[model samples]
Target: MLLYGSTDSGHSYKIRAFLLLTASPHAYQWIDLALPQSHRLAAFVAASKFGEVPVLLDQGQAMCQSNAILMYLAQRVGKLAGAETEWQGVLEWLSWESNRIGFSLPNLRYALRWSAQPPEVLHYLRQRVLADLARLDAAVSAQDFLLPSGPSIADLSCSAYLFWLDQVGIDESAYPHLQRWLARLRALPHWQHPDLAMQAVAPDTSLARDE
Candidate 1:
């Protein structure tokens, strides 16, 4: 198996963490997006139609999208997202995360780190982020994970971008339940910080550049 991904990508980190947590055998190649050479790679470009990172090349097949890869790998291992009883709930949260957190917080993070924008634009994104976090807070407040069964790919998908909340000027104190849930995830075995997990694969010079 080969993974073509960027070191700073949360989407890439989700797949990397799953593979590592499961002790899956694979080789990872870091893509330096900063280099023009990266975009010109014929094989990678062919594998990823959208020119995105975290493309998992398994058995001569290319799997795109982080959530899809997470679900595929989890189901293959009979863990993470394997419980039939909670499968629908897991899928629901996965869809929700893609539609909700995947857009808002990561957008905010990107804006905060890499883009210059008007105060109004930042404010608008922050509002969206707060609303999404509130939804997650309400869901996980009285439970251990999103589905009430346990942590699944849903939790991994949702929490990926959140590992950088403080870095993006989002106050964790504002959402206590969300913070608690994050803490629980941090305490889990084989839980590596996103940057740390990325580094474990292979260092890319791009890691030093904030985005």
Candidate 2:
């Protein structure tokens, strides 16, 4: 198996973290999207029709979309679903991660870190992120992980972008539960910092660009 992704991509890191957590062995191919003509490469487009990072190549099959990949890996490893209702809860949190935390927080980081978005735009995005963060805090406050069964794909999916909150000046002090949840994840035996775990041959400095 070969996992195609960029080191700077949160989406890619989500998949990488899961593979590590499961002790799944696979080779990683770094895709430098910042390079000129990278998107136009026939090989890359064949692996990723949408010209995105984090495509998992299993045998001859290519998988796209981060959350979709998470679900696939979870099922493959028998870690995502337990009880029918618990599986449903995992799916629910997966949707929330993609729609709420996944979209807002990463964009906010991009705007703050690399983009030239106007001050008003940044402010608007920040407010939205705070709301999403508050909701996430509330959801995870009652337990160590999203569901009673313990850490599932939902936790990894949501935490991808969140681990970088400090880089964007987002304060974790307001959400102690979320912070505790992150600490628990870090303590996992196979866990590694995304930057150290996912290494690209060449870093994409232009990752903040809206794709």
Candidate 3:
């Protein structure tokens, strides 16, 4: 299996973290987003339907989108898939993460770290992130993971970006339960920081193609 991604992307980290935690065998190819699309690996550009990172090539198939890739990995490994009874709930949480924390957190992080946004835009993102964090804290307050069955892809999906909360100046203290949940995830065997989990591979100029 081959996974294509960028190190700084939380979306990409989601798949990398899962692969690491499950001890799954896969080769990771780092696509330097700083380069123009024309200079990216031809195979990656062809495989990525949306022209984005976190594209997984396996069994002669290319899987795009982070949440979809998570679901595929869970099903393939038969681990971290949640209980069959809770499958619907797992899907719901994944959807929620995509729409909620997934939307607010990454954008906020990007605006703060990579590029500057207008003050009003920054305020809106901060507010959305706070609300999403509160919702997550409340959800996990009574349980150790998102689903009662224990850690699933939903937990992995939602928690990936939160690891870099400090980058966006979000105070972790405000969400104790969320913090604890993150700590629990860290305790998982084979867990590594996102940066370490998805290291960059030297770009293969041979694979470069025109856009």
Position 73, candidate 2: lDDT: 85
* TM-scores for every predicted model: 0.89, 0.90, 0.94
Model 2: per-residue lDDT, tens digit, 142-200?
98888887888888988988878888798787799988989989998799888887775
Highest lDDT model number:
3
C-alpha lDDT (0 to 100) for residue 180 of candidate 3? 93
Per-residue CA lDDT of candidate 3, range 120-194, in tens? 999999999999999999999999999998999999999989989989887788899999999999999999998
Judge candidate 2 at residue 118 and give its lDDT. 89
Superposed on all Cα atoms, the candidates' RMSDs to the truth, in angstroms, are 5.1, 5.5, 3.7
lDDT winner between 1 and 3, please give it: 3
Q: Residue by residue across 1-211, what tens digits does model 1's lDDT show?
A: 6777776799998888787767776776677766675555576788886788888877667889998998888887777884678888888888888888888888788888888789998898889898998998888888988877687788899999888888778787789999999998888888889887776445344432211
- Order of quality (TM-score): 3, 2, 1
> What's the lDDT for all of these models?
0.81, 0.81, 0.90
Give lDDT for model 1.
0.81
Off by over 4 Å in 1: 37-42, 200-211
